[model samples]
Target: MTTSMTKHALVVRGGWTGHQPVETTDSFLPFLKEHGYDVRVEDETTVYTETEYMADVAVVVQTNTMNTIAGDELSGLVAAVANGTGLAGWHGGIADSYRNSSEYLQLIGGQFATHPAKAPRDELPDDGTDCFVRHTIDIVPERADHPIVAGISDFELTTEQYWVLSDAYNDVLATTTIAARDFDPWHRPITCPAIWTRQWGDGRIFVSTPGHDLGVLNDKNVRTIIERGILWASR
Candidate 1:
């Protein structure tokens, strides 16, 4: 295992508090440590500018939401990942981060456009309650054989289902469908990639969009998928 060596992982957390960056990143620290990683947690992006650290890093687990990244910082991150350091995150932490950097979006392979409902519901409603009601997510294992999602069956989640603007380069692992509910008023069903992996040079990138809060992250399947994703990306 990569972690059995002197592998280092950096957890950078900051940006929109609504995403609970610190708490969410903190929740994953133990898991990373248990895998034998020399982990470092930072609240700022300055660490990304440290070329020395970025050179040998194994994985970077980011939790920044809707923030601006400096040019040097962004460049440093891109260079590290392109040179083989892994990158992994969930929700706005990775997908919705650095909205202005097209390079960053291309590297991550997707961007969070909207969540549709503040909350989502199982059924469409006559009232506007469907606009923010709890809904279920059906995970389709398109890449069932992939290590990140192997043995994971379809599961449902009651959280913000993200509508992402993505590219065709991603190797989609799982997907969730959005019906033409009152909240979205879509003409037909919209299926979005819920989990995926991509390659950046010699590195791996993994993304999961179901983690809006701890409630969603704590789910057995979601946690397992993320844990496996981190390990897979590191390789």
Candidate 2:
């Protein structure tokens, strides 16, 4: 097909049920359509093998939970994104996924280590979890002006604060405080990158670690950041 007939985006979703891949992926469809992207949704792992899968697609939106992609299938995805196709995902969908694949980690540029999911269900406040619990997402001053975070503030979310051990190859956009937790054996405070972007050849890769549940994604503030990240990561 020609470019005019394309400009579509492929949303591959399916993995663990905890992340509610289907529900969350559905919530994002309209936004892509609003942005002029023809969206195609899939729940199968085989979609990766289709020769034209990435050829006519501007972006690949992955909402899978913990599924693995290996061999040439995985390589195809990396090559596509490296050659100008965009890859965008959030939370476990991207960072915490495919634990055993080095190539996958190299492609996405991050891996999820631990997420502090304590407190009562919805105990954290909206303004800021200032319990020292206070979540202050410090924006990288140089990257503060990025489109994905253009009008966003240093807001807070009471969701699962992901503690990631990411590749230094990323351009970190924002980070939250370093706090000591009993669960972490190291017992040292560590600053976590909440949002980051990386380049794969001629393409773009975007990831955010705040979406631990559907409610988190439904929040206006969280929703906006995710929406912008999707657009920013699209080819």
Candidate 3:
């Protein structure tokens, strides 16, 4: 747990109501406070441009999905992280934001290419196939000794299993396998990272790709990993 008297956390949330950005981000507040952080919640990306403000922040917990970040805001955010401010978030919020910005994607180390099993039928082809399905995540035994996933075990979640385009720079902590199914007719099963941590200069980055909704976020394993991730990432 963080013991810094001046430790602060900023949570920026908005874009794509389906992710319940407000509710999900709010659920982490009490936990942050319990860990002795002064927390701020923002519904806009403008805070990224506040250099003086970002300078004092210890951690940034963002939940914006499918939104474009302005060049200045993106630059400020990247600079802050590179300078040792921690960055952490879940699902689309952190991994899927700023689709057009390769710099942002590279900074985060991953991007959400598709959640093969979570797309609506209407969004699919005329063949009437379904894309969303349930899946299980297995903690990497070698990496399980890491603080964020120390006591976590293999768990099952009935939510969208994201297929992410990730960089090899990430230190993968947990993973999920997608089997070849009717909806996604791939020739072989594909395994992808479910939770990971990385470094950007002096900063820390943590990401988890399982919180499709409150129920998943509420899961004991998922919740514990996320909480630990935040604390571990914070300065």
Using TM-score as the measure, the top candidate is: 3
As for lDDT, the candidate ahead, 2 or 3, is 3
What residue runs in model 3 are displaced by over 4 Å at the alpha carbon? 1-5, 118-132
Per-candidate TM-score against the hidden true structure:
0.90, 0.88, 0.92
Candidate 1 vs. true structure, TM-score? 0.90
**Per-residue lDDT for 6-36 in model 3, tens only?**
8899999998988899999999999999988
After TM-score superposition, the amount by which residue 97's alpha carbon in candidate 1 deviates from its true location, in angstroms, is: 0.4
* Model 2 root-mean-square deviation: 4.3
Displacement of the residue 165 alpha carbon in candidate 2, Å: 1.1
Backbone clashes for every candidate come to 5, 2, 2
Checking candidate 1 for backbone clashes, the offending pairs are 119-133, 120-133, 120-134, 120-135, 121-134
Alpha-carbon shift of residue 141 in model 3 (angstroms): 1.2
Pairs with steric clashes in candidate 2: 129-134, 130-134
Candidate 2 minimal-lDDT segment of 10 residues: 125-134
Q: What value of lDDT does candidate 3 attain over all alpha carbons?
A: 0.87
Candidate 2 structure lDDT = 0.79
What are the runs in model 1 whose C-alpha is more than 4 Å off? 1-5, 118-142
